[model samples]
Target: MRYMAAIVLAAALLSGCQGADKAGVNGSSPSSQPEVSPTAMSATPSAPASSSMEEPLLYIEQLRIIGGGQLVQVKSNIDIDQKSLEQALKNSLQTSDPETEFRYTLEWESPRFVQIRLHLDENSVWSGTFNLDEAVTVDGRKYASTEQPYRNTVVIRAGDGEGSLLFQGVTSGTRRVVPAWNTGWIKPVQTRESVAPSYLFYGQEKHHLVHALTGEALEIPVFAQEKDAYGNDYGYHEMYSDRFYEDFTYMISGNKTLYRVDLKGFTSKKLHVFNKPVYGMSSSPDSKRIAVLTAHDEFIGPGADLTVLDQQGKILHSRENAAFISHSDGFLFVYSLAWEDDSHLILPADRDEHNPLGQIRYNTGNGASSVMQDERITDPLKQDLKEHERQPHNDLLLSGLKWSPDNRFAAFKSGTGAIQVYDTQERTFTFVSAGTLLGWMPDGTLAWADIKDLVYTF
Candidate 1:
């Protein structure tokens, strides 16, 4: 699943574009352009002339921000006199030099408001935010324009000492805003582990961990045993729980053992190991219990086993399944299991006439199990699982299902590409949007990547 996510992320970054168009990084002239969203356009579709016109007149009207703070769309009044508005625009428009100019293109045709695209290009085009609301009269108001140079050198350091970094280009203005770790990064608590390094297939390099936000290097303690089977040193691949940086458990697969380590005391405890090679694991919310799903070929066996163990390596529960044992099959069967709470594990069970993907709620408190169904069956709409939803790959989609930190809501991508949030209390499935699941914000807000792969928060 991690590898799959890496591939998707790579493709998204390569194709990510700003605003409505995948225009060139340096702003292009507004002659021929792609159509913008209706919300971003004015009522008229024909673009006003840019070359011969003395001034580009734009009627100001209702203005609203969209795409977080990245877009501003406005409706221009259609009844205004074109010549008078053009003259007013001429007075307001200014350029620094021949290489830089303010360009405009008209968009949309509707009963009310005309849409326009405005760009200011120096080396790159910039869009600005405006709060103008009043109708234009001849007394022109002077607005100050600032030009910022693109700086090639921008250094960012970890302030809280840990987090993830997203590289971004300047969206607006000349201020060459290179994304830095100091802003828009999530800082987790620092650990003894050095940030993991990017790996190359055939090399003997010392790997380091990078902060999730700051991109700073971090070094994690992988117990006293740090070398692999061939006595080669390698970095660890960690699996963190929902608690994330605040409090969680992590396990390193190298050295054929699982060791639980703390960032504060640097204490190490060996959890478990299959006599043969083991592949993947998932930790419970409280970090007291861990489910280790082993590889199928690790031993000559007809069925694979899912082993639940305490932090001290005490076996609590184990079950057999023909499907659970193999990672080579491209799916982790254990992904179907979601922790309903610290004391309850929700595992998929057999479906019946009423419940489609039946669930078995296993009580970790007493090693008991019970059947659980989607309470929505009582609704008058009465929806059942569709054919495509029952596919084996659909179980993998469950891996995207993220319950809110408080367990109030569960967000997952439906087979149809729409993200749905299941309200545990209300017993209802509400359509959030058509997007890929990212994760929930610390404040419990849901975030996702839309059809275009742009991240959005709700």
Candidate 2:
């Protein structure tokens, strides 16, 4: 019932973190954390070089934050009372006490990176930089180690007049994203065997993939366009079989029927005949599993179902009303359900009294479903919304949720006309232009197409 409120809170919180240019380091206790912007980092000057008799209430170990291709700040969270860290202007490195231990955490400030570390001794904290030297300084405190460098840098260019550009590589660390060639309005593609690859675009009648260099039009007749109420034609979803591309599959949800078609054999199967339209679909990486979702439009609060099938077209599992919520709009947003792997499928679940905007990860092999919670959005906001209108409002904007071929990133189109990419490994997010994410290319670069069928890679 509070799904909408949870989403509103999530958006505001995510935005706040994005706009802030600093990393925050504070005591383990919430009350001890400072409200200072994490970005204000500088080298601290050396202090008097003698240990003071004053006892430290806290023992801070270390803290660091990096952003925009450079280390933004580094502070050794060590109190000056116990040990006189002042060894100014000289860059001498000495190992600290072998028994000393610290805690570390890496946070991606959306488009940037931030890492914070702190040393703690039981309940006490030694907060601030230690061992002043010449290499770097934080808040005027000198340190022996140099700041960490940026991990990556990327550049995106809108295509020339023809709406096309080449895909060379992405700018990261020392490497840069450069184009290899140019062409007319088209969608460039990265294939299994090639990097300087071809283009896939919608022609006057159908879709085609043309070789960028040779100008050869590779015919792909499987993509058929269907017209909507306004007479605008649009193509449906199609994906190739994993691994060798030996087969491909697609879906066509008609008025009362859902068609699962195998492009390799040019065969169509009526997977389901439902009174309500089929709303969502996704396939597993191994091409052996498929999950389909459907919902009803009615006076009932809101409800949806999920059905999984195997390679032999047999129903493996089905859950009715797995997602149910109450809102004035009575909207049940089955945004997207995806297979994390052959055995795991992740779906959005309604936020209840216990779980915040939570997601359900179902293990097909074990029939176990667990919730993967994100604290950023789950935490309640200061403002409250009317209970009846609390249905998830942003679900439609994120209906196109998809995972990259490599499973390292989950790419979804944000309402802001950009793609929000979630790095599974780093547990961080980055933004890209609004394009149809074609998954990872042969060379490990991300590829997508804009409204005009212009392909870009990063």
TM-score of each: 0.40, 0.40
Candidate lDDT (C-alpha), each: 0.38, 0.39
Model 1 lDDT at residue 250: 53
Write one digit per residue (lDDT tens) for candidate 2, span 1-458.
00011112223222333443433333231222222322222333233343433211111112221211112222233332112222321122211122334342233232212323333342221111122233222223323222211101111112232333222122231211223223222443433444445655644444456554455555555434333311211223332221122344535333234455553555666565544545456677666676766664543235667777775556888887665445444332224466777788877666654544446888877778887654323112101111111223444423334545455555665432344566555655554443445444444455544333233221
> Where does candidate 2 stray beyond 4 Å?
1-245, 255-265, 296-302, 324-334, 350-358, 373-444, 452-458
User: Which digits, one per residue and each the tens of the lDDT, describe model 1 over residues 1-458?
Assistant: 00011112322321222233322212333443242222222232245443432332332222221221112223332333323433444443322122434455444333223333444222232222222212242333221111111110111111121212222111111211112221111212223232321211111232233443334543444344444531211222333232223323555445246667564565666677655333335567556777654544544332344567887878888755512322344322223344666677765444554434455677756767766655433332122222223333343344335667676776776543445566656656654443335555444655432222222211
Local error of candidate 1 at residue 51 (angstroms): 44
Q: How close is candidate 1 to the true structure, as a TM-score?
A: 0.40
**Model 2: what TM-score?**
0.40
Question: Worst ten-residue run, lDDT, model 2?
Answer: 148-157
Q: How accurate is candidate 1 locally (lDDT)?
A: 0.38
